[model samples]
Target: MRRKIYTKEQILRAAYEVVATEGFAGFTARNIAKRMGISTQPIYLEFKNMEDLKNELLDLIFSKLKNEIFPVPHTGDKVIDLGLNYINFAKQHHNLYLALYVDEEGGGKKMHDFSFNYFSTLIENDPQYEGLSREQIQTLHTGTWVVVTGLASLASSGSINPTQEQIISLIQRTINNIIAVNETVN
Candidate 1:
Protein backbone atom coordinates (compact mmCIF):
# COMPACT_ATOMS: atom_id res chain seq x y z
CA MET A 1 0.00 0.00 0.00
CA ARG A 2 1.15 3.54 -0.83
CA ARG A 3 0.81 6.47 1.56
CA LYS A 4 -0.99 9.56 0.36
CA ILE A 5 0.83 12.86 0.38
CA TYR A 6 -0.82 16.02 1.66
CA THR A 7 0.44 19.52 1.03
CA LYS A 8 1.18 21.96 3.82
CA GLU A 9 -1.75 24.12 2.84
CA GLN A 10 -4.10 21.19 2.96
CA ILE A 11 -2.94 20.23 6.42
CA LEU A 12 -3.20 23.81 7.61
CA ARG A 13 -6.69 24.14 6.20
CA ALA A 14 -7.73 20.92 7.90
CA ALA A 15 -6.22 22.16 11.11
CA TYR A 16 -8.18 25.38 10.80
CA GLU A 17 -11.40 23.45 10.37
CA VAL A 18 -10.57 21.27 13.34
CA VAL A 19 -9.71 24.21 15.56
CA ALA A 20 -12.66 26.28 14.39
CA THR A 21 -15.16 23.52 14.89
CA GLU A 22 -13.72 21.73 17.91
CA GLY A 23 -11.68 24.44 19.66
CA PHE A 24 -7.92 24.49 20.09
CA ALA A 25 -7.92 21.61 22.51
CA GLY A 26 -9.38 19.38 19.85
CA PHE A 27 -6.56 20.19 17.42
CA THR A 28 -4.39 17.14 17.20
CA ALA A 29 -2.66 15.19 14.49
CA ARG A 30 -5.05 12.32 14.84
CA ASN A 31 -8.07 14.58 14.76
CA ILE A 32 -6.88 16.56 11.78
CA ALA A 33 -5.98 13.40 9.94
CA LYS A 34 -9.38 11.96 10.72
CA ARG A 35 -11.04 15.10 9.47
CA MET A 36 -9.03 14.92 6.30
CA GLY A 37 -9.68 11.20 5.99
CA ILE A 38 -6.02 10.33 6.01
CA SER A 39 -3.38 9.04 8.37
CA THR A 40 -1.43 11.20 10.76
CA GLN A 41 1.80 10.69 8.90
CA PRO A 42 0.68 13.05 6.18
CA ILE A 43 0.30 15.82 8.71
CA TYR A 44 3.74 15.17 10.11
CA LEU A 45 5.17 15.22 6.62
CA GLU A 46 3.69 18.64 6.05
CA PHE A 47 4.45 20.14 9.45
CA LYS A 48 7.43 19.69 11.76
CA ASN A 49 5.00 19.22 14.62
CA MET A 50 1.56 20.15 15.83
CA GLU A 51 2.80 23.55 16.93
CA ASP A 52 4.08 24.28 13.45
CA LEU A 53 0.72 23.42 12.02
CA LYS A 54 -0.95 25.70 14.57
CA ASN A 55 1.39 28.58 13.74
CA GLU A 56 0.62 28.21 10.05
CA LEU A 57 -3.08 28.02 10.77
CA LEU A 58 -2.89 31.13 12.94
CA ASP A 59 -1.13 32.98 10.15
CA LEU A 60 -3.83 31.93 7.73
CA ILE A 61 -6.58 33.00 10.11
CA PHE A 62 -5.05 36.41 10.71
CA SER A 63 -4.39 36.90 7.01
CA LYS A 64 -8.03 36.28 6.23
CA LEU A 65 -9.13 38.69 8.96
CA LYS A 66 -6.72 41.37 7.81
CA ASN A 67 -8.01 41.09 4.27
CA GLU A 68 -11.59 41.26 5.47
CA ILE A 69 -11.17 44.26 7.80
CA PHE A 70 -8.28 46.30 6.46
CA PRO A 71 -7.75 48.21 3.17
CA VAL A 72 -11.17 49.93 3.32
CA PRO A 73 -11.54 53.57 4.19
CA HIS A 74 -14.10 54.08 6.92
CA THR A 75 -16.03 56.88 5.24
CA GLY A 76 -18.43 57.47 8.14
CA ASP A 77 -15.59 57.62 10.73
CA LYS A 78 -12.57 55.39 10.93
CA VAL A 79 -12.65 54.53 14.61
CA ILE A 80 -16.36 53.73 14.71
CA ASP A 81 -16.15 51.73 11.51
CA LEU A 82 -13.18 49.80 12.82
CA GLY A 83 -15.02 48.87 16.00
CA LEU A 84 -18.14 47.92 14.08
CA ASN A 85 -16.14 45.74 11.75
CA TYR A 86 -14.39 44.09 14.68
CA ILE A 87 -17.68 43.20 16.35
CA ASN A 88 -19.25 42.12 13.08
CA PHE A 89 -16.30 39.81 12.36
CA ALA A 90 -16.64 38.36 15.82
CA LYS A 91 -20.32 37.64 15.37
CA GLN A 92 -19.99 36.25 11.87
CA HIS A 93 -17.13 33.92 12.61
CA HIS A 94 -17.57 33.32 16.30
CA ASN A 95 -15.38 30.25 16.51
CA LEU A 96 -12.64 31.56 14.24
CA TYR A 97 -12.64 34.90 16.03
CA LEU A 98 -12.51 33.14 19.37
CA ALA A 99 -9.59 31.05 18.19
CA LEU A 100 -7.82 34.07 16.74
CA TYR A 101 -8.51 36.58 19.52
CA VAL A 102 -10.14 35.09 22.61
CA ASP A 103 -8.26 31.83 22.94
CA GLU A 104 -5.29 32.94 25.03
CA GLU A 105 -2.79 30.26 24.09
CA GLY A 106 -3.58 30.11 20.40
CA GLY A 107 -4.05 33.84 20.05
CA GLY A 108 -0.33 34.60 20.32
CA LYS A 109 1.49 37.94 20.28
CA LYS A 110 1.43 38.15 16.48
CA MET A 111 -2.34 38.33 16.56
CA HIS A 112 -2.11 41.00 19.24
CA ASP A 113 0.40 43.06 17.24
CA PHE A 114 -1.63 42.72 14.07
CA SER A 115 -4.73 43.98 15.87
CA PHE A 116 -2.82 46.82 17.56
CA ASN A 117 -1.31 48.02 14.32
CA TYR A 118 -4.64 47.83 12.54
CA PHE A 119 -6.40 50.10 15.04
CA SER A 120 -3.37 52.32 15.63
CA THR A 121 -3.36 53.24 11.96
CA LEU A 122 -7.04 54.12 12.15
CA ILE A 123 -6.54 56.29 15.24
CA GLU A 124 -3.54 58.08 13.77
CA ASN A 125 -5.35 59.15 10.64
CA ASP A 126 -8.85 59.84 11.93
CA PRO A 127 -9.60 63.58 12.06
CA GLN A 128 -11.68 63.09 15.18
CA TYR A 129 -8.55 62.06 17.09
CA GLU A 130 -6.14 64.48 15.42
CA GLY A 131 -5.25 66.29 18.64
CA LEU A 132 -4.47 63.20 20.69
CA SER A 133 -0.88 62.90 21.85
CA ARG A 134 1.23 59.87 21.03
CA GLU A 135 0.66 58.44 24.49
CA GLN A 136 -3.04 59.28 24.37
CA ILE A 137 -3.33 57.67 20.97
CA GLN A 138 -1.54 54.58 22.19
CA THR A 139 -3.84 54.41 25.15
CA LEU A 140 -6.88 54.78 22.97
CA HIS A 141 -5.65 52.06 20.65
CA THR A 142 -4.96 49.61 23.46
CA GLY A 143 -8.20 50.49 25.26
CA THR A 144 -10.24 49.93 22.14
CA TRP A 145 -8.63 46.56 21.56
CA VAL A 146 -9.33 45.52 25.13
CA VAL A 147 -12.92 46.67 24.96
CA VAL A 148 -13.62 45.01 21.64
CA THR A 149 -11.88 41.77 22.54
CA GLY A 150 -13.56 41.74 25.94
CA LEU A 151 -16.94 42.39 24.38
CA ALA A 152 -16.45 39.57 21.91
CA SER A 153 -15.33 37.21 24.63
CA LEU A 154 -18.25 38.11 26.86
CA ALA A 155 -20.79 37.88 24.08
CA SER A 156 -19.42 34.62 22.71
CA SER A 157 -19.28 33.08 26.17
CA GLY A 158 -22.82 34.19 26.96
CA SER A 159 -21.68 36.49 29.73
CA ILE A 160 -23.32 39.43 27.95
CA ASN A 161 -26.42 39.00 25.86
CA PRO A 162 -26.53 42.09 23.71
CA THR A 163 -27.62 42.23 20.11
CA GLN A 164 -25.00 42.96 17.46
CA GLU A 165 -26.21 46.54 17.08
CA GLN A 166 -26.17 47.02 20.82
CA ILE A 167 -22.67 45.59 21.08
CA ILE A 168 -21.41 47.86 18.31
CA SER A 169 -23.09 50.82 19.97
CA LEU A 170 -21.50 49.98 23.27
CA ILE A 171 -18.08 49.76 21.68
CA GLN A 172 -18.56 53.09 19.94
CA ARG A 173 -19.72 54.70 23.18
CA THR A 174 -16.70 53.31 24.98
CA ILE A 175 -14.36 54.72 22.36
CA ASN A 176 -16.09 58.09 22.63
CA ASN A 177 -15.72 58.04 26.39
CA ILE A 178 -12.05 57.30 26.08
CA ILE A 179 -11.61 60.17 23.67
CA ALA A 180 -13.48 62.53 25.98
CA VAL A 181 -11.30 61.60 28.91
CA ASN A 182 -8.18 62.05 26.82
CA GLU A 183 -9.40 65.46 25.71
CA THR A 184 -10.00 66.68 29.28
CA VAL A 185 -6.64 65.37 30.47
CA ASN A 186 -4.65 66.76 27.58
Candidate 2:
Protein backbone atom coordinates (compact mmCIF):
# COMPACT_ATOMS: atom_id res chain seq x y z
CA MET A 1 0.00 0.00 0.00
CA ARG A 2 1.26 3.47 -0.86
CA ARG A 3 1.18 6.16 1.79
CA LYS A 4 -0.69 9.33 0.87
CA ILE A 5 1.58 12.34 0.99
CA TYR A 6 0.23 15.88 1.48
CA THR A 7 2.56 18.81 1.11
CA LYS A 8 2.22 22.19 2.80
CA GLU A 9 1.28 23.80 -0.49
CA GLN A 10 -1.46 21.25 -1.01
CA ILE A 11 -2.80 21.90 2.43
CA LEU A 12 -2.77 25.64 1.91
CA ARG A 13 -4.58 25.28 -1.38
CA ALA A 14 -7.17 23.06 0.22
CA ALA A 15 -7.53 25.49 3.07
CA TYR A 16 -8.25 28.28 0.61
CA GLU A 17 -10.85 26.11 -1.07
CA VAL A 18 -12.46 25.48 2.28
CA VAL A 19 -12.53 29.14 3.12
CA ALA A 20 -13.77 30.08 -0.32
CA THR A 21 -16.71 27.75 0.02
CA GLU A 22 -17.52 28.01 3.71
CA GLY A 23 -16.27 31.44 4.85
CA PHE A 24 -14.08 32.28 7.83
CA ALA A 25 -16.65 31.18 10.34
CA GLY A 26 -16.78 27.75 8.76
CA PHE A 27 -12.99 27.45 8.54
CA THR A 28 -11.64 24.68 10.70
CA ALA A 29 -9.03 21.93 10.81
CA ARG A 30 -11.73 19.36 10.33
CA ASN A 31 -13.09 21.11 7.25
CA ILE A 32 -9.67 21.42 5.62
CA ALA A 33 -8.73 17.87 6.56
CA LYS A 34 -11.99 16.62 5.15
CA ARG A 35 -11.45 18.61 1.99
CA MET A 36 -8.13 16.83 1.52
CA GLY A 37 -9.41 13.49 2.85
CA ILE A 38 -6.70 13.60 5.47
CA SER A 39 -6.27 13.79 9.22
CA THR A 40 -6.43 17.07 11.09
CA GLN A 41 -2.95 16.36 12.43
CA PRO A 42 -1.27 17.45 9.23
CA ILE A 43 -2.90 20.87 9.48
CA TYR A 44 -1.61 21.43 12.97
CA LEU A 45 1.80 20.12 12.00
CA GLU A 46 1.97 22.54 9.08
CA PHE A 47 1.21 25.49 11.29
CA LYS A 48 1.40 26.39 14.95
CA ASN A 49 -2.37 26.72 15.11
CA MET A 50 -5.48 27.72 13.23
CA GLU A 51 -4.46 31.37 13.42
CA ASP A 52 -1.23 30.64 11.57
CA LEU A 53 -3.04 28.83 8.79
CA LYS A 54 -5.61 31.64 8.60
CA ASN A 55 -2.85 34.25 8.34
CA GLU A 56 -1.36 32.35 5.41
CA LEU A 57 -4.78 32.12 3.82
CA LEU A 58 -5.31 35.87 4.29
CA ASP A 59 -2.02 36.55 2.49
CA LEU A 60 -3.06 34.36 -0.41
CA ILE A 61 -6.48 35.97 -0.64
CA PHE A 62 -5.11 39.51 -0.39
CA SER A 63 -2.60 38.85 -3.17
CA LYS A 64 -5.32 37.50 -5.42
CA LEU A 65 -7.64 40.46 -4.64
CA LYS A 66 -4.87 43.02 -5.17
CA ASN A 67 -4.25 41.59 -8.61
CA GLU A 68 -7.93 41.69 -9.43
CA ILE A 69 -8.51 45.37 -8.59
CA PHE A 70 -5.16 47.10 -8.98
CA PRO A 71 -3.58 48.41 -12.16
CA VAL A 72 -7.10 48.73 -13.40
CA PRO A 73 -7.15 49.18 -17.16
CA HIS A 74 -8.16 52.48 -18.70
CA THR A 75 -11.92 52.13 -19.00
CA GLY A 76 -12.48 55.83 -19.78
CA ASP A 77 -13.94 56.10 -16.26
CA LYS A 78 -11.49 54.60 -13.82
CA VAL A 79 -13.50 55.41 -10.70
CA ILE A 80 -16.81 53.96 -11.88
CA ASP A 81 -15.21 50.96 -13.55
CA LEU A 82 -13.20 50.22 -10.44
CA GLY A 83 -16.38 50.23 -8.34
CA LEU A 84 -18.01 47.86 -10.80
CA ASN A 85 -14.98 45.62 -10.70
CA TYR A 86 -15.08 45.54 -6.92
CA ILE A 87 -18.77 44.66 -6.85
CA ASN A 88 -18.29 41.93 -9.44
CA PHE A 89 -15.40 40.48 -7.50
CA ALA A 90 -17.48 40.33 -4.35
CA LYS A 91 -20.38 38.70 -6.10
CA GLN A 92 -18.11 36.06 -7.58
CA HIS A 93 -16.12 35.46 -4.43
CA HIS A 94 -18.91 35.81 -1.87
CA ASN A 95 -17.51 33.56 0.81
CA LEU A 96 -14.02 34.85 0.40
CA TYR A 97 -15.37 38.36 0.36
CA LEU A 98 -17.17 37.73 3.61
CA ALA A 99 -13.99 36.42 5.09
CA LEU A 100 -12.08 39.45 3.95
CA TYR A 101 -14.68 42.03 4.90
CA VAL A 102 -17.27 40.60 7.28
CA ASP A 103 -15.25 38.20 9.38
CA GLU A 104 -14.44 39.27 12.92
CA GLU A 105 -10.75 38.78 12.29
CA GLY A 106 -10.30 41.74 9.99
CA GLY A 107 -7.53 42.32 7.49
CA GLY A 108 -9.37 44.95 5.53
CA LYS A 109 -7.05 47.78 6.59
CA LYS A 110 -4.59 46.65 3.97
CA MET A 111 -7.33 46.68 1.36
CA HIS A 112 -8.46 50.10 2.55
CA ASP A 113 -4.96 51.55 2.27
CA PHE A 114 -4.45 49.94 -1.10
CA SER A 115 -7.78 51.36 -2.23
CA PHE A 116 -6.69 54.88 -1.31
CA ASN A 117 -3.51 54.53 -3.35
CA TYR A 118 -5.35 52.81 -6.17
CA PHE A 119 -7.84 55.64 -6.36
CA SER A 120 -5.03 58.16 -6.10
CA THR A 121 -3.31 56.59 -9.09
CA LEU A 122 -6.47 56.70 -11.13
CA ILE A 123 -6.93 60.35 -10.24
CA GLU A 124 -3.34 61.17 -11.12
CA ASN A 125 -3.52 59.44 -14.51
CA ASP A 126 -6.73 61.01 -15.63
CA PRO A 127 -6.72 64.54 -17.06
CA GLN A 128 -10.24 65.12 -15.78
CA TYR A 129 -9.13 64.94 -12.18
CA GLU A 130 -6.10 67.18 -12.78
CA GLY A 131 -7.98 70.33 -11.81
CA LEU A 132 -8.72 69.06 -8.28
CA SER A 133 -6.38 69.87 -5.41
CA ARG A 134 -4.59 67.00 -3.66
CA GLU A 135 -6.84 67.22 -0.60
CA GLN A 136 -9.96 67.32 -2.76
CA ILE A 137 -8.78 64.32 -4.75
CA GLN A 138 -8.09 62.34 -1.59
CA THR A 139 -11.54 63.15 -0.21
CA LEU A 140 -13.20 62.09 -3.43
CA HIS A 141 -11.16 58.91 -3.54
CA THR A 142 -12.09 57.88 -0.01
CA GLY A 143 -15.78 58.73 -0.46
CA THR A 144 -16.05 56.72 -3.66
CA TRP A 145 -14.47 53.71 -1.98
CA VAL A 146 -17.07 53.86 0.76
CA VAL A 147 -19.68 53.47 -1.96
CA VAL A 148 -17.70 50.66 -3.58
CA THR A 149 -17.23 48.72 -0.39
CA GLY A 150 -20.81 49.14 0.75
CA LEU A 151 -22.16 48.19 -2.64
CA ALA A 152 -19.83 45.22 -2.72
CA SER A 153 -20.96 44.05 0.68
CA LEU A 154 -24.54 44.25 -0.44
CA ALA A 155 -23.81 42.46 -3.69
CA SER A 156 -21.69 39.80 -2.03
CA SER A 157 -24.43 38.98 0.45
CA GLY A 158 -27.04 38.85 -2.32
CA SER A 159 -28.89 41.67 -0.69
CA ILE A 160 -29.05 43.47 -4.00
CA ASN A 161 -28.19 42.74 -7.61
CA PRO A 162 -27.58 46.16 -9.06
CA THR A 163 -26.88 46.34 -12.75
CA GLN A 164 -23.58 47.69 -14.02
CA GLU A 165 -25.29 50.79 -15.34
CA GLN A 166 -26.84 51.41 -11.98
CA ILE A 167 -23.53 50.94 -10.24
CA ILE A 168 -21.74 53.27 -12.63
CA SER A 169 -24.45 55.85 -12.14
CA LEU A 170 -24.20 55.59 -8.41
CA ILE A 171 -20.42 55.97 -8.46
CA GLN A 172 -20.63 58.92 -10.80
CA ARG A 173 -23.13 60.56 -8.53
CA THR A 174 -20.89 59.98 -5.56
CA ILE A 175 -17.85 61.43 -7.27
CA ASN A 176 -19.81 64.40 -8.43
CA ASN A 177 -21.27 65.01 -5.00
CA ILE A 178 -17.84 64.89 -3.44
CA ILE A 179 -16.53 67.34 -5.99
CA ALA A 180 -19.47 69.62 -5.35
CA VAL A 181 -18.85 69.59 -1.64
CA ASN A 182 -15.17 70.21 -2.19
CA GLU A 183 -16.05 73.19 -4.34
CA THR A 184 -18.48 74.46 -1.71
CA VAL A 185 -15.71 74.41 0.90
CA ASN A 186 -13.25 76.00 -1.48
Candidate 3:
Protein backbone atom coordinates (compact mmCIF):
# COMPACT_ATOMS: atom_id res chain seq x y z
CA MET A 1 0.00 0.00 0.00
CA ARG A 2 1.22 3.50 -0.83
CA ARG A 3 2.07 5.49 2.28
CA LYS A 4 -0.93 7.55 3.35
CA ILE A 5 0.26 11.09 3.86
CA TYR A 6 -1.65 12.98 6.53
CA THR A 7 -1.42 16.69 7.12
CA LYS A 8 -0.63 18.09 10.54
CA GLU A 9 -4.22 19.35 10.75
CA GLN A 10 -5.59 15.89 10.09
CA ILE A 11 -3.48 14.37 12.83
CA LEU A 12 -4.44 17.14 15.22
CA ARG A 13 -8.12 16.59 14.45
CA ALA A 14 -7.76 12.88 15.10
CA ALA A 15 -6.11 13.69 18.41
CA TYR A 16 -9.05 15.95 19.22
CA GLU A 17 -11.48 13.16 18.49
CA VAL A 18 -9.56 10.91 20.84
CA VAL A 19 -9.82 13.48 23.61
CA ALA A 20 -13.41 14.46 22.91
CA THR A 21 -14.60 10.88 22.99
CA GLU A 22 -12.35 9.40 25.66
CA GLY A 23 -11.12 12.47 27.55
CA PHE A 24 -7.50 13.56 27.88
CA ALA A 25 -6.45 10.13 29.21
CA GLY A 26 -7.07 8.77 25.73
CA PHE A 27 -5.06 11.43 23.96
CA THR A 28 -2.18 9.41 22.59
CA ALA A 29 -0.48 8.82 19.27
CA ARG A 30 -1.73 5.26 19.13
CA ASN A 31 -5.31 6.29 19.68
CA ILE A 32 -5.04 9.19 17.26
CA ALA A 33 -3.69 6.88 14.59
CA LYS A 34 -6.40 4.34 15.32
CA ARG A 35 -9.03 7.02 14.98
CA MET A 36 -7.58 8.06 11.64
CA GLY A 37 -6.88 4.48 10.59
CA ILE A 38 -3.30 5.37 9.90
CA SER A 39 0.05 4.43 11.40
CA THR A 40 1.58 6.47 14.19
CA GLN A 41 4.39 7.39 11.79
CA PRO A 42 2.20 10.02 10.16
CA ILE A 43 1.57 11.72 13.49
CA TYR A 44 5.24 11.70 14.35
CA LEU A 45 6.18 13.10 10.97
CA GLU A 46 3.63 15.93 11.22
CA PHE A 47 4.49 17.00 14.78
CA LYS A 48 7.82 17.25 16.58
CA ASN A 49 6.68 14.99 19.42
CA MET A 50 3.66 14.08 21.52
CA GLU A 51 4.20 17.10 23.75
CA ASP A 52 4.23 19.38 20.73
CA LEU A 53 1.12 17.63 19.50
CA LYS A 54 -0.53 18.10 22.90
CA ASN A 55 0.31 21.80 23.01
CA GLU A 56 -1.01 22.23 19.49
CA LEU A 57 -4.11 20.26 20.37
CA LEU A 58 -4.67 22.52 23.36
CA ASP A 59 -4.38 25.59 21.13
CA LEU A 60 -6.85 24.11 18.69
CA ILE A 61 -9.28 23.20 21.46
CA PHE A 62 -9.05 26.67 22.98
CA SER A 63 -9.57 28.34 19.63
CA LYS A 64 -12.48 26.07 18.80
CA LEU A 65 -14.04 26.70 22.19
CA LYS A 66 -13.41 30.46 22.13
CA ASN A 67 -14.94 30.77 18.69
CA GLU A 68 -17.74 28.21 18.82
CA ILE A 69 -18.79 28.28 22.44
CA PHE A 70 -18.47 31.93 23.44
CA PRO A 71 -20.87 33.51 20.98
CA VAL A 72 -24.41 33.34 22.27
CA PRO A 73 -27.53 34.53 20.48
CA HIS A 74 -28.17 38.00 21.74
CA THR A 75 -30.65 38.09 24.61
CA GLY A 76 -30.36 41.93 24.38
CA ASP A 77 -28.33 41.58 27.57
CA LYS A 78 -24.71 40.55 27.27
CA VAL A 79 -24.02 39.75 30.93
CA ILE A 80 -26.90 37.31 31.21
CA ASP A 81 -25.87 35.84 27.91
CA LEU A 82 -22.42 35.11 29.36
CA GLY A 83 -23.86 32.77 31.97
CA LEU A 84 -26.24 31.19 29.47
CA ASN A 85 -23.47 30.58 26.96
CA TYR A 86 -21.32 28.89 29.60
CA ILE A 87 -24.10 26.50 30.54
CA ASN A 88 -24.91 25.88 26.90
CA PHE A 89 -21.27 25.04 26.22
CA ALA A 90 -21.21 22.56 29.11
CA LYS A 91 -24.40 20.95 27.86
CA GLN A 92 -23.25 20.74 24.26
CA HIS A 93 -19.66 19.70 24.86
CA HIS A 94 -20.11 17.54 27.94
CA ASN A 95 -16.92 15.51 27.67
CA LEU A 96 -14.70 18.37 26.61
CA TYR A 97 -16.15 20.68 29.24
CA LEU A 98 -15.78 18.13 32.00
CA ALA A 99 -12.29 17.28 30.93
CA LEU A 100 -11.30 20.93 30.99
CA TYR A 101 -13.10 21.82 34.21
CA VAL A 102 -13.42 18.57 36.14
CA ASP A 103 -10.09 16.92 35.39
CA GLU A 104 -6.99 18.64 36.80
CA GLU A 105 -4.69 17.51 34.03
CA GLY A 106 -7.04 19.08 31.50
CA GLY A 107 -5.63 22.57 32.41
CA GLY A 108 -8.46 23.69 34.67
CA LYS A 109 -6.48 26.67 36.02
CA LYS A 110 -5.71 27.91 32.54
CA MET A 111 -9.37 27.70 31.67
CA HIS A 112 -10.33 29.48 34.89
CA ASP A 113 -7.91 32.33 34.31
CA PHE A 114 -8.98 32.68 30.70
CA SER A 115 -12.62 32.65 31.73
CA PHE A 116 -12.17 35.26 34.45
CA ASN A 117 -10.21 37.65 32.27
CA TYR A 118 -12.55 37.26 29.32
CA PHE A 119 -15.82 37.58 31.22
CA SER A 120 -14.52 40.30 33.47
CA THR A 121 -13.88 42.48 30.44
CA LEU A 122 -17.46 42.00 29.32
CA ILE A 123 -18.79 42.60 32.82
CA GLU A 124 -16.78 45.80 33.02
CA ASN A 125 -18.54 47.03 29.90
CA ASP A 126 -22.10 46.10 30.79
CA PRO A 127 -24.30 49.08 31.56
CA GLN A 128 -25.88 47.23 34.45
CA TYR A 129 -22.55 47.34 36.24
CA GLU A 130 -21.73 50.89 35.18
CA GLY A 131 -21.50 52.63 38.54
CA LEU A 132 -19.38 49.93 40.17
CA SER A 133 -15.72 50.74 40.77
CA ARG A 134 -13.00 48.56 39.34
CA GLU A 135 -12.52 46.83 42.68
CA GLN A 136 -16.26 46.31 42.99
CA ILE A 137 -16.42 44.94 39.46
CA GLN A 138 -13.61 42.52 40.22
CA THR A 139 -15.46 41.34 43.29
CA LEU A 140 -18.59 40.90 41.22
CA HIS A 141 -16.58 39.07 38.58
CA THR A 142 -15.24 36.63 41.15
CA GLY A 143 -18.71 35.98 42.50
CA THR A 144 -20.13 35.55 39.02
CA TRP A 145 -17.33 33.16 38.22
CA VAL A 146 -18.28 30.99 41.15
CA VAL A 147 -21.92 30.90 40.14
CA VAL A 148 -21.15 30.18 36.50
CA THR A 149 -18.62 27.50 37.39
CA GLY A 150 -21.04 25.74 39.73
CA LEU A 151 -23.82 25.82 37.17
CA ALA A 152 -21.48 24.57 34.46
CA SER A 153 -20.20 21.77 36.72
CA LEU A 154 -23.77 20.67 37.44
CA ALA A 155 -24.62 20.82 33.76
CA SER A 156 -21.52 18.88 32.75
CA SER A 157 -22.28 16.21 35.33
CA GLY A 158 -25.87 15.88 34.03
CA SER A 159 -27.12 16.80 37.46
CA ILE A 160 -29.19 19.72 36.23
CA ASN A 161 -31.12 20.55 33.11
CA PRO A 162 -31.92 24.19 33.62
CA THR A 163 -34.00 26.14 31.18
CA GLN A 164 -32.51 29.29 29.71
CA GLU A 165 -34.97 31.43 31.58
CA GLN A 166 -34.19 29.73 34.86
CA ILE A 167 -30.47 30.13 34.34
CA ILE A 168 -30.89 33.78 33.41
CA SER A 169 -32.88 34.40 36.57
CA LEU A 170 -30.35 32.66 38.74
CA ILE A 171 -27.44 34.54 37.22
CA GLN A 172 -29.22 37.85 37.53
CA ARG A 173 -30.03 37.13 41.14
CA THR A 174 -26.48 36.11 41.91
CA ILE A 175 -25.08 39.26 40.39
CA ASN A 176 -27.58 41.40 42.23
CA ASN A 177 -26.81 39.74 45.53
CA ILE A 178 -23.10 40.15 45.06
CA ILE A 179 -23.45 43.81 44.19
CA ALA A 180 -25.80 44.36 47.14
CA VAL A 181 -23.40 42.75 49.56
CA ASN A 182 -20.44 44.61 48.11
CA GLU A 183 -22.26 47.93 48.44
CA THR A 184 -23.30 47.11 51.99
CA VAL A 185 -19.77 46.19 52.95
CA ASN A 186 -18.42 49.42 51.60
Tell me how candidate 1 scores on lDDT. Answer: 0.76
List the candidates' TM-scores in order: 0.82, 0.78, 0.85
Q: Single out the weakest 10-residue window by summed lDDT for candidate 2.
A: 66-75
Clashes of each: 0, 0, 0
Writing each residue's lDDT as its tens digit, candidate 3 over 56-165 gives 88778777766777756658666677778877878878887777767766856777777767767776777876778778878877887788879988977888878778
Clashing pairs in 3: none
The lDDT per prediction is 0.76, 0.80, 0.79
Q: Estimate, for each residue in 8-93, the C-alpha lDDT of model 2 and write its tens digit.
A: 88989998888778777678899999999989988888899998887787777666765766446545677777777778878888
> Please, what are the lDDT tens digits per residue for candidate 1 over residues 29-121?
999999999989988877888888887887787777667665444437676567667766777678877777767766778787877777677
Better of 2 and 3 by TM-score: 3
Ranking by TM-score: 3, 1, 2
Instruction: Estimate the TM-score for candidate 3.
Output: 0.85
List the candidate 3 regions with Cα displacement exceeding 4 Å. Answer: 131-134
